[model samples]
Target: MSEPTAFLLAMLAIYTLPWLLWRAAGQRSWLPLVVVQIVGGVLAGPAVLGAVFPDAHGALFTPGVLGALGGIASWAVMLFVFVAGLELDLPDAWANRRDTATTAGLALIVPLLIGAATAALVMRDSVWMGVGAARWQFLLGVGLACAVTALPILLLFLERLGILRSPLGQRILRYASLDDLIVWALLAVILVDAEMLGRQAEFATLFALATIAARRLFARANERDRIPLALMWLLVVALGADWAGLHYMVGAFLAGSVLDSDWFGIPVIDEWRDRILTLLMPVFFLSTGLRTRWEMGGMDVIGVALALLAAIVVGKRFGVLLAARILGWAKGEARLIGWLLQTKALIMIIFANIMLDRGVISPTAFTALLLAAVLSTMLAMPMAQRAIAARDADKG
Candidate 1:
């Protein structure tokens, strides 16, 4: 088949197959469409499809086709990350500073410590560590991957649960917002290229100044013009960061972080985010799956995934439960919050993708992380719903 034909065929499959499977599965509440798409991506990847049917896989996922899909996926994720930054509510976090700090801190740190320890054990074999990574870098990367909460996906879950605008939802958002900022900051630190130190410094200085000016411009501009300006800024900053040896996604998050969500209105931002998730992010998921490797053996990858999931679930719950006891929160609140915070779907994948790009983690490590993320996310809704139900029954 011609390249164009192959590319079109691939696009059709990317868009349709996941949705079909999701529908076929009866769209269980515990298994969201996003999770299905992620699993679909893995199923379509080399370890599964390529191994099972190499000729068909090669025909559809040609280098030229993959390259084109990659470009789209890159832009799609940048847009998603930028939106995540824009949605952060720092003012509210400060208003509830003590509680937010205590909860977010423990929620983040516990998982991180557990994940790092797990990483140390996993890395003993050496096959899981990326070629360019130091021991510390690998450990830190894996730890942070475990701690990340996917803010956008969290929003979707909250909305689905009918509590997005409730006090509980807002509180959850605040904790996640704080975690998101710190996680990205640490990622930037990890990505700091020693050889490109000078360029990175220059980018930082210029970016700070540009951010001040952009905020002013955004504040002054009419609503209609703000979106276009934001998109331009996203492109410029993402390019600048990539050139500075920080990944473009880091730049993308920075691009949105400084801007106020109120500038474009929450409804507009919500609609935009939803559209991106619906139309573009599946390609990103597919691209992620294409990178999966199981050279260390499929069972080994599964074992690593399950181990990482255990660390995240246990660490998150223990930390949140600790915080709840200290703060005097009602019974069951900690369990619900813990499950929700441990939902690591897109953000963890994005985090691991960067580590993979920087060679801080191998393809085998990436595959494990990806699998863990999908499983953890699948567990969140059902577990959270049960916690909620149990809480309500006790109150009754």
Candidate 2:
């Protein structure tokens, strides 16, 4: 209750909270850690605790720390995308063309329809005017975010049910891989266009296109024999984005899609994933946990919460399911598409942090989105696990 005591407790939080998140993330589920951080931060600081003495404590996500965390997260993204590139079946590409087309269509079109409708009808008032998302662009961001399911999560879910190599599972994975790759392309073009039109950053899009061409040229010159140097080339693109005032993630994503073509072999990507996933990504996650704040953000932003849920659960998953059905998939395959496609993690938190920091959405909206994302991941995964398990059991 005393000023000095509250200050000490606040200081303790910065260190203690991250440690707990670090531990929670080690158990292979960092989603809950995001929730804990937000709750813990509010409990320790001025929003709740410092009400008695307004200036007694501190803020949770300071700008300097956020920037550092952003840099760290960019690395996690690079590692994540690199692995995504490897998961694609380059040799069997022709065999899965129908599967990829169906999955990509369902993933984007269905949820986009749901999100646009939801925004116009359900969240019409915009709760706090400037405090929440505005413009059709923001809605498009919501739709794109929902439409593109994380192939990584789908892969993990399939493996858990021991269906990674199953016929149906592999087909679904191929579609997921293709869709994810295409999603990155869509996202890159969006970001590039956003900068061009919104900010009138006249040189941004052209420079980005040039970077892609240049990286490719360099990559080709040395070929696969120069992966180490190519990685250095990739890092240049990443850091160059930071220096250029564009988000580094856009660069990393573009690189991944371009690299997703199986530049050399799967072994290279497999090794990269093993090192990055098992180590660096967790630290990046814990850092995100440390930044999330729940106190200032309340249930007032229910629209944002509902929007996140609709996108992840319906748009992303159901889209994949629709694709499979259109391709003459059986009921079980369709269900698996729906189930596996909904497993979202990592990127949800990452983008939540981005939108929040950029003022695209309020802290309240950010907070609500994070919570909804946490709940979405928790709810979807168990259902997916059971469905995949039951499907496999039936096969036996």
Candidate 3:
């Protein structure tokens, strides 16, 4: 329509250029892309460049856009969860069950407690919040903090650390798989409580119908059954949920968690899951950055910044460390493991969106928690890496 709309789109192109170049260069590290998504969105956002575009194409930044992006992101995430379930290879995890169980359990529980305590300390008064959360934000924040580390991030990081296939690696991956189960379950409860979902039975009934349909169709599936057919299954059920006023993510996640027992044995199923999750999932992460409001960078944000960031980083990292030590991991490994395990990602965005969808928190608070989340991620990846490397060097 005018020069500005095209110019804004051009800026988006420039921001995406490096990401495309990095992908071409074979980089598996995600930091660069993560940075681009946030920076690009910020540079083009209403808060920062609103004065520039004043009122760009109104539809570009509509609620519908966010909702659609979230749905797509949820699917990408569900694919990863399905792959996680496929990768669990329960027989192997069972062999290493003790360590897997211990680490996963500590990872989920510790951060929650720490988040609750942290929220209690600094969340007095409304602080100009808009999500309707006078106190519930902290409670929700604790759940978000403790139970919601990133499985996808850990998987990527584990491969880089040279520990993904080690004895320790097996434990970590399996532990992450188990932890995702907890995270998804916790997410369901929170979503239903906040009315992002209705009664749990809506999910249960939908799942049961899905189960019967799956058993009949995939009773004797092979790679042929794994591919386009499986993809169709996910799409159909997810769409059905939307038509029924149900959340698709819960359905998709349930589909993933309750994987067919022969999932790993069925090479085709495993292959499809891997390719889709690895490739398509980054779209979810990129959209997460898009949702962030970078205009939050100011004195107005500094107050909650301290409490939220400290709770997510210090409280989570140390609490997991303590639990691991109690579980008999050596102090060095426990600390390192704690750091490795707490890298935040999709869960934060997903849970926070759920809160916003249900009116549990304000848009301003969502922006604040999201800001805290970004700071935590910056702190987490490097810290976990260094801690893990130091422990390895000591062992060496």
Candidate 4:
């Protein structure tokens, strides 16, 4: 088959297969469609499909088709990350500073420490570290991936739980929002390249100046023009960041972080985000799946994934429970909050992708992190539902 035709067929399958499987499971999967999309990607990837049906896999994902898919995946992730950046509502987080800071701090720090320790243990074999990465870089990169929370995915889950506008949900948002900021900032710090320090510095300086000018321009612009202007801004920042060796994903986040979501109309922005996720992000997941490997041994990778999942779940639970005790919250609040905040899906996967791209973690490490993320996300809903239901039963 022609490459273009194969690519089109691949796209068709990528979008359809996950949704079909999702429906086949009676359309009430414990895992969200997004999570299923990821699982489908893994199943379709070289590790499974390519290993089992090598000829078909090779024919469908030729070099040219893979290159085309890569390009689309990169842009799709950039846009998705940009939407994440734009959604940050720092003012609300700061207004509830005590709660936000305390919870966010405990939630982030405890897991980070545990994840760092896990990284240290894994690195004792020297096979888990990425090429050209120092021990600290590897440790920090892996640590933060565990610490991440997918705020958007959390929102989706909360809506399903019928608490999206509830006090509990809002509170979770604040905690996740504050921690999201820290995650991105720490990511930038970890990605700083010594050799490209000058380039990065230049990008930072220029980005600051551009942010001010762009904010002013956006404030005065009509609603109709804001979307295009935002896209233009996304391109500029992505190009500049890539050139500066900071990676385009970082650039994408920074670009959107400086813009006000209100300026673009919250409804419109939300719609755009949904549309992008629907149309483009499946390709990104597929590309990510293509990169997975079990070079360190499948058993070893599974062991590491399970260990990392435990550290993340336990650390988050312990930390949030400690915070609840210190703050004198009602009973069972800690369990609910911890389960919600420990949810890791899209954002954590994005972080791991960046770490892998920068050679701060090997493919084996990336696979482990990816598996942990999927499992953790799939667990979030059922656990939180049971916790909340028990709390209500006790109240009754």
| Candidates' C-alpha lDDT | 0.92, 0.58, 0.59, 0.89
TM-score of 4: 0.97
Question: What number of clashing residue pairs does each candidate have, in the order they appear?
Answer: 0, 1, 5, 0
Cα-based lDDT at residue 52, candidate 4? 94
Give the Å shift of residue 95 in candidate 2. 4.2
Q: Residues 7-55, candidate 1: write the lDDT tens digits.
A: 9999999999999999999988888888888888989999899999999
Residue 147 alpha-carbon offset, candidate 4, angstroms: 0.2
Instruction: State TM-scores per candidate.
Output: 0.99, 0.73, 0.77, 0.97
Model 3, position 250: C-alpha lDDT score:
50
Candidate 4: clashing pairs of residues = none
Give the Cα error of residue 148 in candidate 1, in Å: 0.3
Worst 10 residues of 2 by lDDT: 125-134
Q: Candidate 4 lDDT, tens digit per residue, 286-342? A: 998898887565789999999999989988898898889888888878989899886
TM-score, model 2 to reference: 0.73
Of 2 and 3, the candidate ahead on lDDT is 3
Q: What is the lDDT, from 0 to 100, of the residue 257 in candidate 1?
A: 90
**Ranking, TM-score, top scorer first:** 1, 4, 3, 2
Query: By lDDT, highest first, what's the ranking?
Result: 1, 4, 3, 2
The regions of model 1 sitting more than 4 angstroms off are none
Better of 2 and 4 by lDDT: 4
Whichever of 3 and 4 has more TM-score, that candidate is 4
